[model samples]
Target: MENAPLPSKPHYAILDGLRGVAAVLVVIFHLFEAHATSHLDQIINHGYLAVDFFFLLSGFVIGYAYDDRWQKMSIGEFFKRRLVRLQPMVVMGMIVGAAFFYFQASKLFPMIAEVPVWKMLLVMLIGFTLLPLPPSLDIRGWQEMHPLDGPGWSLFFEYVANILYALFVRKFSNTALAVLVFLSACFLIHLTITGPNGDVIGGWSLTPEQLHVGFARVLYPFFAGLLLCRTIKLTRVNNAFLYCSLLILAVFAMPRIGGADRLWLNGLYESFSIIFVFPLIVFLGASGAVKSNFSARVCKFFGDISYPIYITHYPLIYTYTAWVQDNKIPIREAFPVALLVLASSVALAYACLKLYDEPVRRWLQKKLGPAKVYQKA
Candidate 1:
């Protein structure tokens, strides 16, 4: 009975709502990203920080979900649970990218026309495994690890974080975890402030520099989230969903600080947000209650679709980006079309959630049997 799986605990609904909010902002950021010349000039400038926010959220959730269950759960079982939760969307995201692969061909993706169908399928297969592709295998000129879906790179690193947590970090004392989080924060600050771009972007590629950026970006937020879950005492907050959602938006939409001459200032802002602001938001969100029926429903809906939208929306973004680049369309001219793309992406994500993701996960869980479940703390 110790090894038998248990029922799922109730979720922190407001946190789910916040995740959906950040995901939607990511879509808008990418839409605006298609128009920007560089990281410094990009509109919705801080949108990339959403990835860090996500890492933090993931760490906290993982801690909440699994920390108590380890006594009953083996590491292998833990991996099985995570795979069941995350892998389905990973597969679907890649397929969506492949389905829209050729449609994205344009001056921006010069290599698409040259890529054979078999090769594209091959890339999709590799993407299915969530393995980072070497630059030589890059079918798209963008040199992304998963060209089929750019955001898949984050999922790859996400898997890395999960592996670390399950294998080792899960056993750390609260003090040790805090120390690790501190060191990670220092590394993140150093990397962000000293980097050529002065931002925590460029973790999608498999290059050494990008890999460094990837590790730097992931470690602090993820472990800090874990540390947070371990140490913090929750207090009830009013309108946690509303307040946290607004904070996420404000952070992601904040303009680039200090401009080109003061790149480190922008880095400092990003560091402060991840280290201080995000944890506060998560804590507040966890402390919040969904008292109103309307608020509960909103949180439920957003929470349900958050991962679906985050994982699957980028293929449409690829097409929209191609259109913008090929025609050199300005943001004003492309606003209507961008809105349509956002709508379509949302629709696609909801459809995937209902038709594909939910059904598939149920089937897999049924087949795999339950691993472990913890009661709400």
Candidate 2:
């Protein structure tokens, strides 16, 4: 289906809602983890894998969003829409992350003490995707914002995948095979070439040997989503059941992520986040239905805030956790506080999307002109 005709758009409230579900899952998961320790968070700890869920959603949405011009899209317009849609909030997220860390630097990241303030600022700016760099080819400043830290890594890949779709996606024969080959080469290469802890696995450093090798591995998951997006269709009973089942599976898988016993889950989430979760989500999402249940609203709302929630929850987790540690708050109070953090984050995200994201996206679109129609290759 990766090479098939593009699917229809709209009435995909379900897909968008699922995106919301992934967002809220991450938020709630973080909220639970930030406070009282829980076997629930760990056992169901696989909720963090919701990012992979987003990747698959992204691929399909990109496919659906640009179905008409998939074969003829200009890199400029494709990127313009993406930048318009994603940047303002992303930049805001970076600023928020940086400001929060700066205000509490003494408590937030001890690593900043080693690097000069200028260097840290550079990292923050590089990580932020809102800004564009010069054409000199020497600035090395394309590093989208890591303000919320690690999750920002996915945004860069999403941009690349989307652009690649615009430019080269039409010509690839057996795109699924191409994706698998890409995933395999990356994983095998990383396993063979790296130290016990090479650069491709973690986020503390993006330019180290690890990042050089790690980026390859991420493609597997991201493209897996793209592939799923191409193929997925929804039914009433079976599809809804499947999505619910996958959520159940992830819940069960979560506990397998925490503590001394969770080495593989932790490693997988860190190293092959895409490989691990993309297939599961794609399978479920493609097959899942948008049922008329109350939970559906939760899915839509969180999916809406998933972006903001994803960006905002971390600071709240770190800051709230620190306060809990310092004050020795009981599990009960910490749990409630975590819930409040999520509620507040969602409210903030609503404002961010409604006020900042919507307007900025329109303004950018007007300046960039319309998306070019297909002249299929």
Candidate 3:
């Protein structure tokens, strides 16, 4: 059973739902993060790791879906399929970000409204292509590659991983891939241990240092996940989804293990969690089955909306963060508003999914050619 060949097009239903679960946690974590002064005391301290988990999951899914199909699928076709599945949401996220930009302005961005409409629109235009603009083009104070939409940074890195996979990584032997994972793991460890913040946090900006962080953060888990899918030996596990979900929450919600004084300890924990825990969680998720129709539907709904919610919700978060900053409201007092923001983000994501992303993707697939066999979400 451990070495079983997967069904031709098996759906990793539990993995999909768990991806949604992590996305939701990321929103919660970001909401609470606005209130914290530092990582040491930040609520949902490790939620940043969700991005890494996503990378890992992506690698695993890509390997599972396309590794053997390379015999028939052109690299160009692989790129096209990915663009169809991912680019629609990327465009929507940018549009949402730009539309909400003015609402997010406050003392933090006092000149936001005064900035020329053409400049903002220019940023949004660049955003649609998923390209990172230089700092000179950064209208927002954060120096993000996509100032209009901060999450665009991750998508940029995601594309880098995809290109590497298509052109180079797909050809590696098992030993070579193991070595790649090891080297990436080393870089990750060094980064975590020496990072000024003692965590894997700063990757959104376009600066050289930030790009280094981004690449370092992505390389391991993505490749590791690819390797995991190739070598995974599944086993029976009862209540796998519930257990794995809890495991993920525990890692993300766990307080920073070592304070700033013992930075190595924190670094070790972060590295170990990514290098070991995340892949294990993904494996458990893949092995699990959705045993009930209710569970099946729940998984499908979350899976369907997960990417939409992730890409689009950040604009709403920017608004909420701005409000919290403007009012100087503490999280305790702003609790009700925080709840509203969370609920609204979910509602907005679902709306975008049905109203925009799904339709655009369907149109894209139709125009591009028949869709590939991989699952969309």
Top candidate when judged by lDDT against the true structure = 1
Summarize candidate 1's per-residue lDDT along 136-166 as a digit string, tens digits. Answer: 9999988899999999988899899999998
Root-mean-square deviation of every model: 1.6, 6.6, 3.7
Q: In angstroms, how far off is 232's CA in candidate 1?
A: 0.5
Give candidate 1 misplaced runs (Cα > 4 Å): 1-3, 371-377
lDDT scores in order: 0.90, 0.55, 0.87
Off by over 4 Å in 3: 1-8
- By lDDT, rank the candidates, best first: 1, 3, 2
Q: In terms of lDDT, which candidate is stronger, 1 or 2?
A: 1
lDDT of 3: 0.87
TM, every model:
0.97, 0.73, 0.96
User: How big is the positional error of residue 264 in model 1, measured in Å on the Cα after superposition?
Assistant: 0.6
Name the candidate, 2 or 3, with the larger lDDT value: 3
Q: Which of the numbered candidates is closest to the native, going by highest TM-score? A: 1
Question: Any residue pairs clashing in model 1, and if so which?
Answer: none
